[model samples]
Each structure stands twice: as C-alpha cells, then as structure tokens.
Target: MLETTETATDPKRARILDGALKMFLAYGFSRTTMDDIARAAEVSRPALYLLFKNKTDIYRALASVVFEESIAKARAELAGDAPLGERLFQVIDTALISVMAKIAESPHGAEILDMKGSLAGDVVEGWRAAMVGQFTAAIGEEARATGVDLAARDLSPVMLADVLFDGLEGMKMRVSGAEEQRKAVRGLVKMVELAIRP
Candidate 1:
C-alpha cells in the first residue's frame, strides 16, 4: 500500500497533482521525476516532498481523484432525463472510455499504463469496484423505472453489470483509438438496451 501525506483535495495537494499528471503524461511515469513535478507545480522540491513522499504517490493521488470524478459523472449521467440508451451510453462514456482514451492519446500512454500494474494495484482495484457498482446501480434503477423484471430473463443487476464491465474492458483491448472506442461503446449500449428495454 502507498502512504500519503495529505488528501488530494487539499489546495496545495491538488496543485501538486495537476503538475504531476502533466509531467507523467508528457514524460511517462517511468521517466518523470519529483523535481519535474515540483518545478511544474511551482513548489520547492523540499516543499513538494513535504506533501507527497514521491512522484508515484502524487500519481496515485491523481488516479484517486480521477476515479472519484469519473464515478460521480457516471452516477449523474445515469440519473439524467435522457432516454435509456443515451443515459446508459453516457454512464459508460464518462466512467470508462473517457479516461482510457485520454491516456491512450498521451505520448507515453503505454508506459504509464504499465506503471499501473506495479504501482497502482490498490487504486486500480478500488476504481474497478466503484465503476462496477455505478454500472450495477444504473442498470437496476433503469430496470425498476421501466418495469423490466430482469429476473424473468435469468439476469440480475449484478450479472448484467459484470457483463457490461467485462465487455467494455475487453473492447478497450480490441480497439486502437478513441474514436473506435466511442463507436464500440455505443454498440454495447444498444445491446444492453435490447436486454432490459420495456
């Protein structure tokens, strides 16, 4: 587990994270340095150290904040007045595809993604759980609102949510770029609409 000096929401901490993310995306996680972050953040190296133990800690904080924002966006999108398919599409778009596509566009995207395997296991796991929960809630709420008894089709909220998550994750691997990802997500949304539509 990683240790942190302060929450990412702290004004100073947020400034540090913004700089750290810029450095990481611009230079890649394996190549970015704490000094780079401090310079970009306009903090002395020692002052930056006072808030974050290292660059990786700052990176983890950014990931946490991004996850939180994504989940909140997804939840709000699900609760919107859009039609079911559009709402569901927005949920996945906001939560999954948006960040993934942003990273994939970065010059060091692959390297940064590889860092996730070694440095961000816990944060990544938490993100996955939260994303799945958001999907499950949205699906269940839609089902109830539309009087779709998923149990009659041998499906539960958890089941459909798991399938959606797994399918989207797989789709990421299969696609090459952001545009393809958006199109694929819509196809998945259409399939989901068919399953639970009234």
Candidate 2:
C-alpha cells in the first residue's frame, strides 16, 4: 500500500501532484518550485503549502502515485490466469516498458524520474522490494506447479527474482525506444520460460 504524505484522491491534492509533475517534467526537478506548481495547479501558494510542505514534498507525493500505480497494475496483470511467460510479460510491460515509454515522451522526463539525491529514494526502493517479493512468490508457485526442482538447479525463487529484476532494470536503462523495449522484454520472457520449462 502507498503511504503517501497526502491522500491522492482529493481533487485539490491530485491537481497539485499532477501540476507538479508537469512543472517538474518541463523545468526539471531542480528548477521546479512550489510557486510554479501552485500556478500550474491553479491553487494559491498558501493553499499548496497547506497540502504539501514544500517542493520535495510534492515530488515525493508525485513519485508515490507513480510507483503505486505501476506496481498495482503489474500485480493485477500477474494475478490473471495467463501462462507464466505471458504473465511475466504483462508484469514487465506495465511496470517498466509502458511507464518508461510515457516518461520518455515528456520534456526533462528523465530528470524528474531520477530518484538519486531525491527525497523519494526510499519510496522507489520500497517499490523495488515489493516487486522482487511479488516475483519471488509468483516464481516459487510456478516452480512447484511445474515440478521444477529449483534445489537441483541450484536456484531459489528469490535468486530467480533478483536476476529477473536486474535484467528488467537493465532493459529500462539500456533500451532506447518503446518498440525496442517490447522486443527485448519478449526475448527475456522467452528465456525465462525456457529456463522454467518442465
């Protein structure tokens, strides 16, 4: 569950976060200010302060929404009754490829998405751990169902999840475009399916 500093559903709060996202993407996080967010949001500066402590607070809130939605969508995909490889592909598409593609289309998007030196690093880390845990559980269940002897293979579900997560992150960093990413994820998913085949 997302522990956002502010509730995301409130219209005013949503407006603030959405407006902040636009400002941050347009100007980069370092250059975006509370005034800019307030102006963009159509809220008074004092009203913005009432909702968020400052620029970092808005950034963190915005990040929480993004990460929460990404994980939620990925989890929903995994919960479907698709084959293991298809499910994994859905997870990757929702969590990384689709999200990254949207961000890539925005101005200064990468700068805003950069978690380093940001107050929301913990938020990003939490999301990562959650994804790893989800993948580990899913992979363990699949292995059991398929009668794959992970012990004989010298692999554990967590280790498998770690490798998969690393590869997914690498793709996010190295893949240049949406179509390329889709192809890369397909190849990775195929490899995972082969590795786990009964």
Candidate 3:
C-alpha cells in the first residue's frame, strides 16, 4: 500500500496560505477575494482555489492556528513550578499581552477586531473556554492544597472562570494604543490576582 503524503507539501501552497492570511488580515473576510489572494501570493486563481475553498475557509484555518498557538503558549506559561497564584498570573498576563501585540502590529487591527462576530466566532469562543477551564482547574487545585473543600463552595469554578475571562476580553477590546493595552492588561492581571486570593 502507498502512503499518502501531505498535499500542502508544495511551497506554493504555503505561500498561498501566508499571502491569504496577510490579505485577510488586511482586508477582512467581507473584502478579500480569491483573486486578491492569488495576486498577492503570485499564484494563479486556480491554484488558490485548490488550496482553500473560500475566504471563510482560509479565515477559519488561520483562526484555528492562532487559537491553538495562543492556548499552547498559555499552557506553557502555566507549567512552571512557581506558586499557583504566580502561575495563573503569568498565564493571563503573558497570553493577553501577546494577543494585544499581534493585533496592534496588524495592518487590519480594526478588521481583526470584527472577526469575533464572524464565522470565526466559534474559534474565538472555543479558545476562551479552554483558557478559562484551565484557570478554573488550577484554582481548584490550589483550593485543595489549602485544605478547602471546593465541593461546599457557593461559587463554582466555571462561574469564577467566566467572570475573569469576560473581564479580560472586555479590557482587551477597550484599549486603543499599545501603552493603553499594556496598562489595561496589567490592571486585569491585578484583578485576577485579587479575585483568586484566598
């Protein structure tokens, strides 16, 4: 039996994806066309179609990659042997700061902001859920360490996590400048620290 190799093996496909991402980031889902992506990538329209089904598909692919990358970074940041409080703060601070930096550097920062309500909505929400769940689990672990019975708690981990995640997202959307973004995120980091304190 012959093994199937990856079709994306061609450098041309990678170029198309890279170019498409830039175009999508520049023009957004509603404005970008396959032709624009092909032109930017220096590939034929037919070639672009072969690589991606449509603009939505390309955006989904890019969003998935971005989401997974952010999640991995947050998880790695939380993997330290530091105290639970410090680990949680590191994860929130590092991940939010990285996300803000990416948005600030993008040419279509406003377009990127609108992506949360598009088809990529699921990707964004899914990532948020995973991040919050991780934080909640960490909190529960800390509670156990402190001899507190989480079972008798009035506040569930999910509730607490949702509040923190929503607050972080709100803060991220409100900041316009890089300095403001940094300040807003630091404030959020401090809020999370206060909230998680025993």
lDDT per residue for candidate 3 within 1-198, as digits (tens), equals 101123245667567667877776687757888899899889988877887898788777666666676777778867778876567666765666666566657777667657656768888889888899788877666666666654565665566677777877777667666567666656655565555456
- In order, candidate lDDTs are 0.80, 0.81, 0.69
lDDT score, candidate 2, position 147: 96
Assess every candidate by TM-score.
0.90, 0.90, 0.78
- Predicted candidate 1 versus true structure: per-residue lDDT over 73-134, tens digit per residue: 78788778888789878777766777767886889988877777578889988888887887
Which pairs of residues collide in model 2? none
How do the candidates rank by TM-score, highest first? 2, 1, 3
Write down the RMSD of all candidates, one decimal each.
3.5, 2.6, 4.9
Error of 2 at 153 (Å): 0.5
Clashes of each: 0, 0, 0
Measured by TM-score, how close is model 3 to the native structure?
0.78
Please give the RMSD of candidate 1 to the true structure: 3.5
lDDT of 3: 0.69
Flag regions of model 1 displaced more than 4 Å: 1-9
